[model samples]
Target: GAGVSQTPSNKVTEKGKYVELRCDPISGHTALYWYRQSLGQGPEFLIYFQGTGAADDSGLPNDRFFAVRPEGSVSTLKIQRTERGDSAVYLCASSLSGLLADTQYFGPGTRLTVL
Candidate 1:
């Protein structure tokens, strides 16, 4: 895909269940990010990966939320022991090298509903 692509446009899961959101970044993009957006709020950074290692993950709310980019092209956000508060739109973004001048391309987020 020319742009970032996320899997499962919407997800409905019961409270306490686990969920995984996938993202496929554009070809040649070495930087990938995961974010979460609640209702009436802007996206909040959750994690950022440069290549296969996490460059920054200070935005993650808690220990339950984790993201990984094993191959540096595909990334996944994993939520363990989900709660109702965890419901939000999971956004994925990618850039050339995570440089200051790089432009981030975002994917259509996956809306997660916890009930």
Candidate 2:
């Protein structure tokens, strides 16, 4: 793949509902990251993956938020009992490696709305 791709560009759901956001990263990239951006705020790192394991998941708010990269290429973020505050744009990025300074290219974010 040339770049990251995210599905369901826009999502709407009730506050208690669950949602799954998908991301397909660039081919051969060894690192993938997930971020959540609230209105007027910069993206906050939610999780990072190197290969098939989650390298860092400290940014996830709580048990309600979970993510997985089963095969090191495609990843899914699952949200349980979504709240109104969870409404934001979910962004996915990938790089040749997950270095702090490496250029991280992003995909068009999936805008989530919790009513």
Candidate 3:
């Protein structure tokens, strides 16, 4: 009934721990996106999935970060060996379609604090 939503609004973990952030997009949306936003910086696109496949993943810094949308509705972002620099707000967004003019709606985000 609403737009996209993310879970674990705040997460605190040790540097070497693994973390999983979840996102639930609006029903019927064919495009989903994951983004990372540092304090005072704009959200940077990490991975975008059109349907069930990643359309773009160039923004992922390394293999430590990965995302998946198995059934094309709920997606998860996984981080391995988290670091201090890896701390940021993970945002999820969705669009009706991946078309150029399809407006993307973003969720509140999950704040990750790596200690």
Candidate 4:
């Protein structure tokens, strides 16, 4: 019954540091997504997980970004060698299905600041 939720509402880290951002999708949702939003722009898709496997991860910027949804409910986004450019509001969303047309419920997002 709970909506999507992201932990560590704000994160501050230096460049080259590794950070892990957590997300809890809605109960029983089969689809989960991760996005990054920069200033003056809409949220950019990063990855999509259906059940326990990643269905699409083409939106990930580079090898530095990775995400996993083990057991199909909780997910964690891992960033390695963080850079100032990686600073953004990391968003998580979930839908009933992994359909493009399905409405997604979004979380508040975790604001990451890379110094």
After the best TM-score superposition of candidate 3, give how far the Cα of residue 67 lies from its true spot, in angstroms.
Answer: 0.5
| Global CA lDDT computed for model 1 | 0.94
Please write out the lDDT profile of model 4 over residues 29-111, one tens digit for every residue.
99999999999999999999999999999999999999998899999999999999999999999999988799989999999
Model 2 residue-pair collision total: 0
For 1-115, candidate 1 gives per-residue lDDT tens digits of 4778999999999999999999999899999989899999999999999999999999999999988888778999999999999999999999999998689889999999999
Q: List the residue pairs that clash in candidate 4.
A: none
Q: Give lDDT tens digits, candidate 2, residues 2-103.
A: 778999899999999999999999898899999999999999999999999999999999999999999889999999999999999999999898878878
**Cα lDDT tens digits for candidate 3, 1-115:** 8989999999999999999999999999999999999999999989999999999999999999999999999999999999999999999999999889789999999999999
Clashing residue pairs in candidate 1 are: none
* RMSD each, Å: 0.9, 1.0, 0.7, 0.7
Candidate no. 4 TM-score: 0.98
TM-score of each: 0.97, 0.96, 0.98, 0.98
**Hey, what RMSD does candidate 3 come out at?**
0.7
The better candidate by lDDT, 2 or 3, is 3
**Candidate 2 weakest lDDT stretch, 10 residues:** 95-104
The list of candidate 1 runs beyond 4 A from truth reads none
